[model samples]
Target: MTSAQVEKGSEHTSEEGYERGLGSRQVQMIAIGGAIGVGLFLNAGANIAKAGPSLILMYAVAGVIIFFIMRALGELLLYRPVSGSFAEYSREFLGPFFGYFTGWTYWLLWVVTGMAELTAAAIYIHYWFPDVPQWASALGFLVVLFVANLISVKLFGEIEFWFSMIKVTALIGMIVIGLGVLTFGFSAAGDTAAVSNLWAFDGFFPKGIGSSLMTLQGVMFAYLAVELVGVTAGESENPEKTLPKAINTLPWRIGLFYVGALTVILCVVKWTEFAPGVSPFVKAFAMIGIPAGAGIVNFVVLTAALSSCNSGMYSTGRMLRTLADSGEAPKAFNKLSVTKTPALAITVSVLFMGIGVVLNYIVPEKAFGYVVSVATAAGIWTWLMILISHVRYRRAVEAGRLPASSFPAPGGSKGSYVAIVFLLFVTGLIAYDSESRVCLYVMAGWAVALGIGWAVLKARNPQIAERREPEFEKV
Candidate 1:
């Protein structure tokens, strides 16, 4: 082989050494796709039930807090861009256990989320075929998403781009249609609902700030996947450029796409009238007298679920590679296929998704609710670690132990601690809310399970013991 070919061949495998295959558009759309998941498509109804019209403001507040969290993540990812970006940062900044815990924890998180997304796809399809077995739909999604992930990362990117575009178009369409109904009295549903619908009932904050506070749990869950951008940084073709561009625009994107869409819904429909039986987005369209509103929203939500499954596959594969590289997982996971993809990791992760089918067949009704609640809590835990890692990162930078990066987090270590506190507070609130209280218990149980697994792994692996020397030296 030619020298260049030899280099390329060697570069495609390993954890920290994979070729950068993701482009700017891929990174951007993946973020756009992953962040706007089935939550916004279906969970908006639940949020409205929590705080009424004030749900819109809750989304805005959650968006702002998550904005800072992403900023911290962006700065760290740029500083040490790698395949397991955040997990690697946790290890370097904190300790081996921190990295090991974060990586495995995140792996478990996405596995649960992937199953939930597959289940969601199945449930949506059931609207057309009420008699179709739920497992059939879940299994179908498992096969489709598995194939999409196993092929190539670029192909996944292409699919995610289009997937995200459809949802974005639907959301924008809803916003435009909603504004028309409020302004020019356009009636797609033969009802000219004015903006006054916002407060026509018990006023905007009908349930009071206490209820609004409770709804933030739903809002946080809605924003769970916003970090998909940072995870993509390692694989992005031009991390130095593309990562910054993607991260910089996060605030406005969330504002316009999430807060903006919710605002339009609140204005066009009273919170009292919001029902959990249908999507708020579809309800907005239906207000304009648009037939097949549910069908259109279902299609958009299906695409959203696909987008999430795509990212879930990508993240877990990379994280597995990181685990293998750190000697925290089997060395086989570090190997790549001839296609330069983490084939084994992808296959294992996708195969794990089959559990969704089993869960669906066992208890179809409660499966989604259980999976989403737990996934949301696990996701929040991952973000909390990212914040803590950033705090440590900033201190290293200030102590002159690390290079000053092109992208620096605003407000420094103190701000990072504030971000961490905010996330912990959110987690506590999720536990307090009756709807999401199960998440708190699941998170606690998962942590205990991980601790046990880690202890066993350490006892079995000699390499982990050897690796601990360097970790201790760093500490």
Candidate 2:
């Protein structure tokens, strides 16, 4: 058979393998789990303070961008269902350097994100134990998450499903109570606060467009995890069927969980009065004298942080395995356990995450921003690579070099460019904001590291060097 025929057949082999790993339900919840983060539970108040009632508009706009990007990703995933998904696509469609940079950067993002999640877990634990050391709590959670990941993929999925379910249930409950207070006038502690706090202040956009723009930083990062679904494509039981099913829900998940929840919060409480120190959902319920709102949300946020950390470990492991597969990372990361899980990668990633415990104790005040900025910087790089890779993929298709895809990105090459430009704008905005300036610095340092890596790899591999040599042949 010709080389082309072998390439075509390998596609089928990859799909069959993925089908054995991921199911429909796991795929759906994984997407949901990624989008729902501490940002929703803890950071909502910060957004409110920044944009006031306009925070809703910020989420809505960011949601649209996220939705389209997912669609573009969905199209790419359908055509080439591999273990690394986008990272693999970046290598084949863009180049080896692009792939290496994308995969490692994404891995770095997950590692830093794991750190943030563990740190958040520790701080939340502080609510219950005023005297307990933050480092101790962070360390304890890291150990627990590591063990959970050592099991098979199916087991990991089960744990994440339940963990995410707790948070989802809490948010739904809050929304319900909030609406009840708004419409039927529920009484709490024999006192009633009017529900018109949503608009009773200075109207939506009270913070002006400037604040609304700045709030995008949080919303963007909050939605960063949603793409975790793409990584699961390699492990999914049926990539063709399951992937599309999962991608289709991106809009609904964002709307119901993000937009819906935020709308409820604004409607029940005045945006100006929203405080980051308190859970708006809990405070709203407390306004109606509902008992245990704080405790309930506290427990839920704890679980949410745990789930995010859980996913962080799992995703970073998978990315490491992918890198190893593509000759970008160490060989050990590619080794799988009896459960077909990357055990070594999981262990190493968790070890790095344990630093969160140390940082929590050593520098509790600086830990949050440090973790977030690093994650955001890596996220920008990953998205940029994805868009660039898709652009190349579509060009090959249009030039009749590649087979007609089973699924195609809407608007074809044009859509990819649009997403790329929009993402770049967001990256620029993040850089301009003083709050996100650290992210810029972190990414700059990361790019330099990637450059050094590429240079070393080139010096060692003549074949790679040849590939990097640009051809002068005319298109």
Highest lDDT model number: 1
Lowest-sum lDDT 10-residue window in model 2? 466-475
Per-prediction TM-score to the true structure, in the order listed: 0.92, 0.91
Which pairs clash in the backbone of model 2? 18-236, 19-237, 19-238, 22-236, 22-237, 188-288, 188-289, 189-289
User: Which candidate wins on TM-score?
Assistant: 1
lDDT of 2: 0.75
The digit string of per-residue lDDT tens for model 1 on 1-475 reads 1223223433433234565667778788777766688777777787788788888788887787787888888888666666677787777777777888889888888888888788778877876788999899888877887788778777878888899899888888888877777777666542636667677778888878888888776677788778877777656776777777887888877888888888887777667667763567766665555678767877888878877877788888978888888888889998877666778988888788778889999998888778888887878878888888888778877898776666887877666777778778877788677877987887788789878877877888745634232221343
Model 2 regions lying over 4 Å from their true place: 1-19, 189-196, 465-475
lDDT of 2 by residue, 140-212 (tens): 8888878888877888888888887787778888778777777776655223335455566776777678878
